[model samples]
Target: MLMAMRYHIWTEGCQMNEADSAKLAAGLARLGYQEASRPEEADLAVVNTCVVRQKAEDRAISYLGYLRHLKEKRNPGMRIAVMGCLVGPRVDDLKARLPFVDIWARPQDFDAILRELVPENDLGGEFWPETFPEPRGPTAYVPVVHGCNKFCTYCIVPYRRGRERSRTIEDVRREVAYLCGRGVREVTLLGQTVEAYGKDLPDRPDLGDLMAAIHDTPGLLRIRFLTSYPKDMTEHIVRSVAELPKVCEYFNIPVQAGDNEVLARMRRGYTVEEYLEWVDRIRELVPGCAITTDVIVGFCGETEKQFQHTLDLLERVRFDKVHVAAYSPRPGTIAWRQMEDDVPHHEKMRRLHAVEAVQERIASEINAALVGTVQEVLVEGERGGKPFGRTRSNKLVHFPGEARPGELVQVRVTRASAWSLQGELVAAAAPAGS
Candidate 1:
């Protein structure tokens, strides 16, 4: 009897990359490949990487080094493939640098690796598998949009992933329906700038239209999208969230910096006043909605006063959550080529922690308000042997209950924390909009 060919995929970065990895794994499964727990045990070892931050890039490089050593010392015939942003647009440099890597597939280009691995087979036609592999869990990520057009000065996505492209509503709907059949109850429509979806299509339907198109998916209990651009977040999108029962009342709008000067330097294309107006509009339209944001601290030439502006903005907004990152220049980004990274390393850390501290207090206060309320949670899975899930507002809830994954349950908040809610199971509930 022949031994089964095993493959392993090690992934790093955003939810988009996670979705990409799942798609690739599904493709590999269709080609008669079983998953190996570790790289050493696999016939093919793939590394899906990210270069969004210097730290992320360092981690990818370090892992590749390990794989290189492993191949030379132990697994001489092990095939290694490198994918994602770290591979970039042109792989000649990366190919030369990581010569041991048998395949150098770009981000979301799974066919490149698949073709290389199964050269004897005629694996053509639609790259996506009709049925995803087993153990897909109750929740899954679906990438509606690919790449990005917004070339923010500090961002390397456009350079790495190329221009924006969107999947048609019909195409997205098919995937959602297929995922529903596979026992996925919740789906998060993903993109670098999720709200910018449909701009490139001929009909230009927009994100609101896309959500409405899939609102009636038979088994899908919830819908969500993320990483929105402030300018592209239209009233239509907010209203869609209010009108669509399945769509979660959560928005992840990234305001790279709070000060206008920093915003211009980052080429974010919006002012602090403009961003505030959008936030106010969202709150006015969607009651009890959870608004999250991303902030980059210590961008090129960011002064103490400018950093104080960011602190003030956080205090003013009192966002439900804040994702803060310290600035690290990427080689091809406009910021790296044109400006100086004048902020010291310690100063960057100080600013990053300052934002975290303020946001922590705000999140604690916001969650504290929900202590006596009951949140309808789609029980995703368990943590520490207790069922855990997320509310429509995207707040994590941990409850004491005998609930299986994919079941909807009402959880009465018993305790509140900054990151999650501790709850007691009140009753099982029907899917939302049922």
Candidate 2:
């Protein structure tokens, strides 16, 4: 009997990318491919690439180039596939540049490509999955929708990802039940703008309704969603999060610019006041929730005064984490076409550092306040002779203890830092009430 074709998949970029990878992996397994521990042992390799940032895109391309050498050295017959945003937007260009790539697929067709890679003889054939398969993992990323309706000027997501298409609540529930049955503890509801989930769907059951249904699912410990648009962060979702016990308090909302004019140029829809109001609502609903965000330091036409406004917003928001990105002009973004990339590299760097410094100061203060308080941490793993976990707010808390991944524990924070917290184990795998 022929040995199972070994498959190795390397995922890069967002949670969405990870989710897409899992789907592809599951689809491959159904097609009789087994997971390969080492890339060299694999008959097929898939690189799930990201294009959210210029650096990320550059890294993915560089990785593919490196993989070419790996293919020649190890499995000379190994078929290499590149998926995700990298290929979705530029499949033609990718095929033209890297002719060695056997399968180039988008997020939509990732599973089909993986399923088609089973036969060594058919490695060179074009591939794409005809049916979407529910994926299995300890944690699952359930994308409630695909694509972005919001075309932020600086972002390629709307253009490259196409239009929003939300899955029905029933479809999501079916996937969630499958994941739960597989012992998955966490399910992160995903979308380009998750808040806008179900708007385009025929049934039109809003995100809140979807969340309530998912939250009611058995065996799922944590329910979270991400990358919300401030414009669509409706009152209903806020109330749903506040009321739902299983729903996590952590929210990752990106307010690109603080100044209304800068936000206008970026096409972020909501004003500074509106953004703050959304934050206020979240805080009011979910007190002590760890709020994180994305901030772009220097967009085109950003003056020192506008930059100061950003700093002011940072001071007010006091985000637990800020994914700061300095603006880079991409090939075909609206910002690139209409606005000049006027901000010098040095200036952008300077502003980026400045914002980071402010974030450090704020986080330090927040962490300091937690000294001597016990917080429930979901144990992730051990590192450097210590076990580390995250609080309900997603704050990293480290303590010396013998605990396994996916276990919950309470830690009495003894020390705090801007980036992390040190604590003592108070309890292991205890209930929220206890």
Q: What is the alpha-carbon lDDT for the whole of candidate 2?
A: 0.83
Which candidate should be chosen as best, given lDDT against the real structure? 1
Q: Write the per-residue lDDT of candidate 1 for residues 378-416, one digit (tens) a residue.
A: 988888989999999889999986988899999999999
lDDT values, one for every candidate: 0.90, 0.83
Q: Give residue 231's error in model 1 in angstroms.
A: 0.8
| Backbone clashes in model 2 | 2
Candidate 2 runs further than 4 Å off:
118-138, 429-434
**Model 1 TM-score (2 dp):** 0.97
Clashes of each: 0, 2
> How many angstroms is residue 174 displaced in model 2 relative to the true structure, after the best TM-score fit?
2.0
Please estimate how well model 1 matches the true structure, expressed as its whole-model Cα lDDT.
Answer: 0.90
RMSD of each: 1.9, 3.3
* Lowest summed lDDT window (length 10), candidate 1: 126-135
lDDT of 2 by residue, 279-324 (tens): 9988998888888999998899999999999999999999998989
Instruction: Pick the TM-score winner.
Output: 1
